[model samples]
Target: MIAKLTDIEALEAKGFDAAYPQKSPWDILRHQAETRPDKVAIRYLVDASDPARDEVVTYGDFARRIMGAAKLFRGLGVTPNASVAILAQHTPSAQTAIWGAQIAGRACPINPMLKPDHIAGLLDAANAKVAVIMGVNGELDYWSALVPALREAGVTIPLLACDADAQSPGADGVFEEMIQTASGKDVQPEGDETALAAFYHTGGTTGAPKLVQHMRLNEAHVARSCAIMHDLTERDVVVNGFPLFHVAGAFVYGLSTLSAGGTLIVPGRLGMRNAAFMGSIWQQVERYGVTILGVVPTILASLKATPIDADISSLRWLLTGGSPLPTELADAVEKHTSVPVRNILGMTECAGAIAVEPVHGTRTPMSCGLRMPFSEVAVFGETEGDADPSKPLGPDETGIIALRGPNVAAGYSDPARNIGTFLDGGWLVSGDLGMIDNEGRLFVTGRKKDVIIRGAHNIDPQMIEDALLAHPDVLTAAAVGMPDAYAGELPVVFAEMRQGSQAGEAELIDFLRDRIEDPVALPKRIGTVDEMPLTPVGKIFKPTLRAEAIRWAVGQAAEALGVEAEIAVDEKLSTRVMVPGESVDAMKDRLAGMPIKLSVEARS
Candidate 1:
């Protein structure tokens, strides 16, 4: 039985099996290690820019690192039952840390790049007893004192700083120093494979992040789902360009590729130098005939911006996820390189892809393909009045996507959030607004939560303001995604200055640079407003602000580069703003054609 958003009221949890075959990500990893121990598991291009010293790890060695790191964590007084947290970066060390956590016992991967307050909140929320922070030289906190403050906030968990040297004052233990943290002893997990594999917090409409408890079963299911789509094999050399913290980078795409006994490729970052890295990717492809590779939408878009002369002819597959696959960009890549671009849709809780277009399959612009085996999906009628979740909707109907299979989460870390996100039906509400077509293709329609995806990075506007407000002269600020041509969206800020105190835009930008690690997470452009746009509920009316931003953006575009007489601008606007991707004439015509309507669905 399949459940979707159309008729969510009718779903029930007793409809499916909890313990099914093809479960356990660890089981899959172990299987690959035993079967193809000699096979090259990952070919990490240390610095894609530097070709001379590319490193490779065999399946046997990769498995050993995981086990070794797991043992190391236990030996360091991070007990089995106690929560051990790691902020996974975009490097191979990130992968080792996550896999090691699972081997140790209870592991929950958190985005270490998040603001310190949120990091503190998540650490507190997880009740972590020990944190294996990336060390000072290895640590991202080179300038700021966020780490010290975290320790002060009762996050007195043993902090083992891990840099290249792995030595720093105030450090409880270095990872290498505690190679025998657990010695030959391994902590037995409190729950069996069915207990919980890991916890990942996702954004909710309530503006709070909910911790999703992915089960051991779904972990394997998502991995298999990804492995099958790309025809993952021991010969394939995979590139790990996406953020390891994201589900796509961690499990669905990253682990699945590694689990297949293939060569894993880790690029430094998905920015300007990516094309140069492609030369390195081509070299690995030529050296090992690297067949399969995964790319986030951001890197793909960046690759599209500058011309690539390197022969991607060695490329057999190009799978894209984390955001919608823009058709024009996808087409541009295919036109440049012969590799077919497949759109994949999966979530952190699902473990891997729920659906992915077949390789060399028919291109459908932005179609997220059919559901994997044992996983049922459907579309429902939103206003159908008590709709059935078990039944699939007919053609062209739009609704939320619900999943019931081995690949879904068991429960959440927070008990309160568990009730709303998941119901008595055992169906996780996926908050993503999407629709399934008659042919079973899923199209992501919209997001229920007001999140802004700027260059494939999930930046909650509120999450951004959490940093901006720290500036004494800054009264209040709002974070928004201004439309972009190649970048998709750029972060912008609407802020107010404090009375009797003043701060310039450049000064505020510098202040944020001191506080936040990822400069992109902070607002690129700042505008002072009399008052912030807010809803009656007091949550900043982000939608209204987004609209204003868009309108201002379109107007600026028109004013800077004059538009036709049919489209005139309101001269009162000084700040630059971007509208949703729409032509000026189209938007003007839309406004011109509309007749304002007032309704009383239920009188106020």
Candidate 2:
């Protein structure tokens, strides 16, 4: 289903147009306005002192404003194909900016909350033609301050201000100016399939950012995937507080909802820490009957913690992704809000979620469901070297995941990325260790690079992390595979306690005894930490944590097990065992002192 040059036009006709009437994300929005002009497209929840009052946006009005913003950009000489960067919180304006960019030419969605260094890096990397800065609260921090920094880092893009809150002094007229231009513009894109759409960035585990170049045709395919995956229709309404920068924010939920003719609900920000802000989202859900809600596990976890539970009955389903959902968090979220929650799994390299659990799932369930349409999946045998698909493993056989499909990103911003993930054959290495069951469900087992080997038995860090988080008192946990001289690699778990609650390491060890099927799978060291290290997206940052824990253990993990005074020979085989994480060289050095004889038969 790779959109080949030969079949692209045909595929475009059969796949995209059949599913959606409007050509592009922007066009679909405009079409929604024309067909259902007065329909509500977006409802913005504005936080108030009491946490009940909020704002709203009708589809017809949303379209008019988007057009106005596009016109404003046009008046500012924001020509077609010029990259426009959006630096703002997840809100109606952010969505408007993205649509405006589509109408204007090109849009580069950026995380406004990104660290200054990363922000500068991405700006320079994109060589953005212009930047539209939206206020991050009252700080009024505009993109103007970033101009000099971007120049230093190799970017000279001009910066403009978006109305809400901008910090720059004496800048050009705000986004309103662009909106005025879009209103008056007598010309529009002809829904051209050849038009370049947007660029998305992905940096999962590889620790290096890679850009995903999407053409208009690819976006249309992504829209179709979203439409089907979410079960979206004209009657549906979504509260899209998810960041526009993340895949879940744009491709997974946002643009898909629009193409489906469903209304959108946005908030000033998705920051749940501010009860007032979060309450606004709940208000929209209740007042406007926001049926669809998409968010990350971390955000959902925080929302579950909020005590005030007003009416959220309008929310029929809540979608969570970006990281594995801890079972405890999932259960708590269900208890707090009656909405159904499903875990979605995929990456930016892929347009959106390739696998997601059903919407009506009861309680938190395992396994992201059957592969979506146009997805090719294979689980290669988990081995030490280059992955081989010919020797693919069976159900429950943990291995690297390789996928090829229409929605997969064409290539990274850096062509060199293809060397590791994509071969000449066209498959994309997911870089994740996963398995497909006979039922065709996919279970992601941590990063392939994070596999923990203890003794001869290989361990999955994700498995132990799952067990640790299952503890009632535990809030979040991360298990890092550390070097051990005897067994090869042993796992050290760093965990955090729930707020205002304390649980000892002994309790954790006992909990593991009840949860884990294999005795050896229990964590060797349960280290209590204030919190687990996490990336911006909340996935465990174990490389640095693993290094820190090894130092604290003081070589205990590296020590060999001392022999008992009288070693009894067992007639039966000791199937359940603890072998040391020993390298070949270290194993030989330790074996030199033992009386055990090396046998060719055993070695073979």
Please give me the total number of clashing residue pairs in predicted model 2.
Answer: 23
TM-score for each prediction?
0.77, 0.67
Residue 169, model 1: lDDT of 66
Please give the RMSD to the true structure for each candidate, in Å.
8.1, 14.5
Off by over 4 Å in 2: 1-17, 20-23, 48-55, 68-81, 115-121, 136-155, 165-167, 182-187, 190-195, 204-209, 270-273, 279-284, 360-364, 382-384, 389-391, 449-604
Please report the TM-score between candidate 2 and the true structure.
0.67
RMSD of 1: 8.1
Candidate 1, poorest ten consecutive residues by summed lDDT: 593-602
Q: Give the TM-score of candidate 1.
A: 0.77
Candidate 2 per-residue lDDT, tens place, 1-604, comes to 3112223234445764465555567777777888888776765656534335555667788887877767665665566656577877667777787777777776778755444455666665554667776633463353555545555665555566664543455344466555555546543754476466677765421124456766665566666666665678888887666667776777777778877778766655543334555655576466667788777664675567556445876678888766555454566677778767777776666666566664633332446655555556778864445567667788989888887766666676678866667645557777777888765668775466565544323355666778778788888888765544234345678888888766788878888765653455678788877867777887776755665544433234225534111111222211111233334334333322111112111111
